[model samples]
Target: MRLNRGLPAVASSLLLALPLALAGCTSFGEGSEEPAAASATPTEVEAAPIEWSDCDAQIQPLIEGQPGSERDLLFECGRTEVPISYDEPAGATLPLFLVRATPAGQTERIGSLVVNPGGPGGSGADAAIGLALTLPQDVLGRFDIVGFDPRGVGLSTPVDCIPAELKDRVIASEPRPTTAEQLDDVFALSREMADGCAEEYGDALGTFNTVDTARDMEQLRKSLGDEQLTYLGYSYGTTLGSTYAELFPDRVRAMVLDAAVDPDTDVVADAEASAAGFEAGFDAFAENCKGLIAGCPLGDDPRRFLEELLAQAGGAPVPSSEEGETRQATPGVVLTAVQAALYDTASWPQLAQGLRAARDGDAKALFSLADELTGRLEDNSYSNLLDANLAVNCADTDEVVEETEVRRLVAEWSQAYPLFGAGSAAGLFTCSVWDAERTPVPERDAAGSAPILVVGNQGDPVTPLPGAVDMAEDLESGVLLTWQGQGHTAYPKTDCITAAVNAYLIDLVAPQDGLTCPA
Candidate 1:
């Protein structure tokens, strides 16, 4: 079955949000918007019960015509009426769309395994179906796999303020703007985007932060009839899971936070860490490429080829030869594709092929990869993934780097992190120019909660290895599980990681905190 791949929890302004940014045959309700608002504090409001129904109308279309999809599993959909603003429990409420996928021929069912794919924008509803299709029967048989699009995401009450054309322009812009003129262009674009979101959402925009989403999880748990939450959270979903663990420590039965985001780091710190991680990932790719028989597509030095490609792409448009494709190759698109490929090692060979094609002046391969990363559809229309991405990301943090600081960081990081530095530093301005109050990532600890497993990948590009280490340290009852693997996440991918997680989630047997598995 085709999967909803992992994406970063945090995306840069120029980078765009690429959470599970795969080209799709299934048009899963991409573009739609609902007005949102809230603040103060979460109150004790009874969760509206869920009435489960067939999900075929929405989900079947997604997996039907796809090459490998076998439509054999069962999926049910439901809606939970959650207060849009928990601060006002009796006030306006929005429907939180949910999908529950039953394991193949279950033996004895345990509680639900709430899986979150982790974009502040990632669709949990999509994740539920993906996990159902991919998860092993051992873990699957014991639990009902549940996924829901949190508020401000697909098929739910969304925080969609961004115009499609504007998003296209942002993705096509240069990621690393150095010159004063280029920086000016970025600033102007940022202002226009920020003003538009503000005009659309107003103060209600602030309500789209992480804390509120955590509260939504509480309601989801109650509605699922699970006495405690059993969650499998990834990437930005880790941020949400960690936050939930803190808010309702006692309510967490078993939680596996894979590819975690350190709650303590502010925006700049997170970006810097990502920059360092991407740089390392590129180096690894380069090493692997060099060891190949042909010895790398971009020649012995891939970095130099990228530099040249960026320069040429900026001056004369590098055309995409993808059939019926009209988009030109820009620096933003090139880097976005490269960044996306680095998320998983399986895509490195594809990345090499794209670069080789680019070397031959055909940008078709690059465009294909970039389109998948940005959720740019076959017709050039986009998904609401990026919309909710910017909305929740900005709302989650108050740290906004000023132009001067950004320029300084850009100059310094450009040298510090050779490939991704300058662009990432420029991206620091995304939240700065954003028009919303912040609910900064809180200091998280699953204090009284059951031992929550915090899994980390040594070569994770987006969340990075350090974030997971920090996550384990911060949580009072957190246990660290390290995979010396090279990918975005380690979970059913390897037998070692899978067995440990299955044992922990099913039997409540916590692995030793410092257990490290070889890649």
Candidate 2:
């Protein structure tokens, strides 16, 4: 299936409280509000749990037909124009794109449930429309699942920097900046791309960070004519959800942040945690594959196979197909593929199968699996979202280092994770070269919001489970819901999580403090 971030620890950590930017020149969420004339009573609609009647009639038929599967899902795109800078409402205008599924039946809509799938770069508008059929039935029934291409993402006025071939080249390269020249080359290339992105996207690229996106969410909520905003954000989306809750607690109807990031840490810490997570994932793979050598051909010694792959690929890249298309097939790719596979245990067998193919001298299977991990499938073009990923990450984070400093950081991280840390550090080099202005530090606390739910997976590798616990501790109203699961986000993998979250959405039934479930 689709990738969920990575192992329980890292994937979940990144999901917990990651803060990043979005595309679009807009003010961060800030504005004056008039006092309510009177306190409003809770509607009966709010008291009942999610019911079929809650779903908007306008969007049901489209759900019956798988949109992405058919490619027939009509994209109803609209723009929400917001101020370039929230601090200066008139500085400039940035338009955001919104996509919705038409309700299947002819009934008045109840409200909209906005979605953000994460990545600081993930496109919710595409996901909502494309995956409409697969969402939890109760969720679909109650509210119109609305998705928007966050300011700097797909379908929105996007950021285009590096050429597609160049991006692929970079992504396919080894993650290690072993030589000084190699490190310098990495820095120079990233700097050039960052400068190019800013030159192309202009001031809008500078403003696409997470805080602004959170504000955009508020504006979108207002534009939709909803009294309260209900939302589901996964991966980096958890940051968006938490930020919104902090900024506008009173406006929150319900929200579910699956696989959350630690809200209080700097990006350096996030990256470090993510590295550890990958190691955890590798361990999980080793554990599961050890006894199944006949099916899992990386051999019973996971570490040995991983090391051998890295050494071999690092010395000489492997051709992915007979056409001579090549990739390093290093541990990073193996780990990336493994991370993607960990999203659903159902894919464990597939990963094993790919490993078997690689062992047999057919690298195509491994390459194909790695492609899915990096989102570089044969039919799909490289996304500028990767540029946006850097832009927004640089803009929102307090952690930025020069090449020298990055090298030091990478060295330290490598010690912590001998297998994958160096590569991740090298991969994140783009942030150093990005020109987007930094926000200085996490801004959610100053936003002044509510107790948002932060979910974590016990074995999460990317966004470690501790990240969620840490995030919960940071927020005044934050509550922790731990899932003893293996994926990035808990909701998709477990019915228990869905039920708890649905209860929160429909009847304001928050799970008890520190609620947890078994893997």
Candidate 3:
């Protein structure tokens, strides 16, 4: 339910999305210079190797496993201060935390592979650890796997704009506000979130946009001592990476963007597309459930069960069964849990279990899923995920769809996409109330960049297939690789996708354009 303006972060393969309050306004804060340099070449800088330290402490909190277990590569953590607004490189700066999983034993070097796991708010530091453990040996052998928390995310002096209480209200708010009273509440909440974040962050809120993040990438490249940038971006990471290619196309040696975000879609368009995607993904989940033997947790009709639960939850939240758990499975929370499952088919079975539990009057499973997707912490505190998600999403776009327009879309889309559209249409208002300075994400051709590989999964619920298609079409040298697979991203899933991506990152060889791999 986090009505973000841009695409949500990935949770399973690193993207997570939820309903969170977000807004936009203008101006770089005091001591600001100008926005990031858009010229293809980076500013003159001497090579400065990253100062590394033990990262096990920072990375352990985000993953599962015994403490300090020996692994292929011990992660080394570090940070570099980058301008809060590139317009003022020496002005107020934020520490961009980085984690490097030094390859176990190197063969031939292909430079560092800078990886971003899609959150515009997701933790690249965490992704580096996970990928270090699981990325193909071939990729590891040829490159140093490095990931950084984009400014205002995770360890990067995260954006903590909204108060904890307000964030809870935002999460628990209605998913589909039908009546005038309900709709008004939505607007009021939007205003509250926007005003609060603006008051809290001031002009610095405007600096969290993607273009600036791309500029930060350039700074990171120079700091890493790489002559050229090699990158692997997933989901929204594709957006950031593409912006990098567009800005510093010549600085790029190679890039692989999986589960691409369309460079051209606006807030409303993205929400509508999300509705259609989730609906399709749900259908697939339902169809798969039908094929299971006697153990299909969802009985005869999955959609009906979901609708009934949602309708019931709108009036009274379902109670969770976990011994000390207090969070109720309200319609917004319930829908978020369902949407979370749609990200990966691997989660569908768990989704079924959660639904069955809800039907049986014990909804902790559903509540837990929602908690995870929204980055709710075990201590009942939330991560800065939603706050940063809002800041970046709102900062990236300049569009301002009015309340009336959002109402119209909700009315039309609800009937068109029964389960997901109505609520998602409300996302359009997320940025409308925002008063922050906006830097619109540019449509890119990435002219003169090295061949960039763009991969798409047919069943990705968050960033749909068309985003990849549009991304490939948008890049001058982009090559398209399609996977008839199910999940939020297509990478290291099947041998075909892995080999192609590895080859590209390793040898700068791209799979044939329009290449398709069977699921």
Candidate 4:
């Protein structure tokens, strides 16, 4: 239930399956160069144009039907048409959805604090609604939060590369091929998927990448008339913040990049690191399960329980109690389900209860959990923004290994992490075949006046600790903040982290060079 108590049985490499789309591309310069400063002029921030008639006619009815806190949250609907290519400046137009939420007081407006939740597919509008509830009160009061569905994501001009059946088949694919033939099929499938994207989407896919999104951010800044940008990016969003800082270094007033990803690493590197991180997380989960009987399903030997579970899942899935549905509860599905629950500790108890039920031959609980894991839930327990994620990743990754290479890697990783390596390797199948143009890595130089904060989680099963440490060393003004805990992304969860990040954002106070917090 509590997967982060030790480490995930699977490698965290699947995180890279989404690819590291956060932050600026190499175009920003190398690590040694000083980043340029933002314009200093204080200009009145302009409100985005809202079509009140359009809102009443089209958007209001949709909002009225929604029930709960989202209903109470103020809604401003608007659209911005950006060029398909930033370089072209006046190319084909794409409409982007913009959602704005003003803070309680008008006097404390800190301009628009652009927040991205980082699924590359996560709807910014949805994130804004949830963020309004979870954000630290002090931070919320000071900034007017703006969440936008990035191009080719959410309300934006989204991608429809895979048909519904193909998408379903792809998500439910076996963790790894059992034979050489299967691997070949996967390779062909991956290539086909990527090719489909390119063929279906064409040049429009190129604009969805992070570099272009950063340009979109700049456009947003221009539209708002703000000389500087403030941002809070989570998970993959950290990459976006980093990208923004890289492109418009002078314009970044303050940024909180939670669950940081190293800009220097490609998807391949990210895949390897993520795999290892999840293994570490599974270990933590096992350790926690050992002592807590009521909260954990595994009786006495946690490792043994996991081993048996994996074996059972891999062999043949059992029927679920819920609606008598027959589903393949493969180790991959189980691990993916468990991993999703680990994101927030709030879901731990539910997982524990489900596992307890699973131990009783009621696979329904696990199946339900898996459903939530895959974004079948209405609350968006999973990151449903795969279209944009694919666009960014397909563009960023210059090369994807063939099926043979993937199989070899899987075998190697399996040797390294016996329980979850295959699943991690399998997740990469999607990225390897994503369609788009391959470009050289951009030059990213972080040297500057203000210190850029890099947060790391010690037992993170996604973005490992080494990444933060390495990025800190790479950046000229990088400061490392280590959260000696488990899971991905630390800020807003820990008081110490929140205090540090809040201080940095509010007063431009960077924490000490190497700051670590213990659980």
What TM-score against the true fold does each predicted structure earn? 0.91, 0.81, 0.91, 0.82
Backbone clash total, candidate 2? 53
The list of candidate 1 runs beyond 4 A from truth reads: 1-41, 57-61, 64-71
RMSD values, in order shown: 5.3, 8.4, 4.8, 8.4
State in Å the error of residue 284, model 3: 0.8
lDDT of each: 0.77, 0.62, 0.77, 0.60
How would you encode candidate 2's per-residue C-alpha lDDT over 48-90 as one tens digit per residue? 1111122222333434433233322233445567555566554
* Model 4 / residue 415 / CA error / Å: 0.9
- Evaluation by TM-score, superior candidate among 2 and 4: 4
State the local distance difference test value for candidate 1. Answer: 0.77
TM-score of 3: 0.91
In lDDT terms, how accurate is model 2? 0.62
RMSD of 2: 8.4
Provide backbone clash counts, one per model.
2, 53, 22, 35
* Predicted candidate 3 versus true structure: per-residue lDDT over 1-519, tens digit per residue: 342212232333221221110112122333334344333333543333556777555444445463222455666777676766554555555667787877667888777889988766887866777677777888888888898888888767677777777877877888777777888888888889889888876766777778888988898998988999999888888989999999889999999888888777877788888899888989999988878986678887899988888888877888987888887788888888888788777778989989888877778888777776777866687777787888888888778898899899989998999888877888778888887778878779999998999999888878888999999999999999999988788888899889888888887789999999999
Clashes of 3: 22
Lowest-lDDT window of 10 residues in candidate 4?
1-10
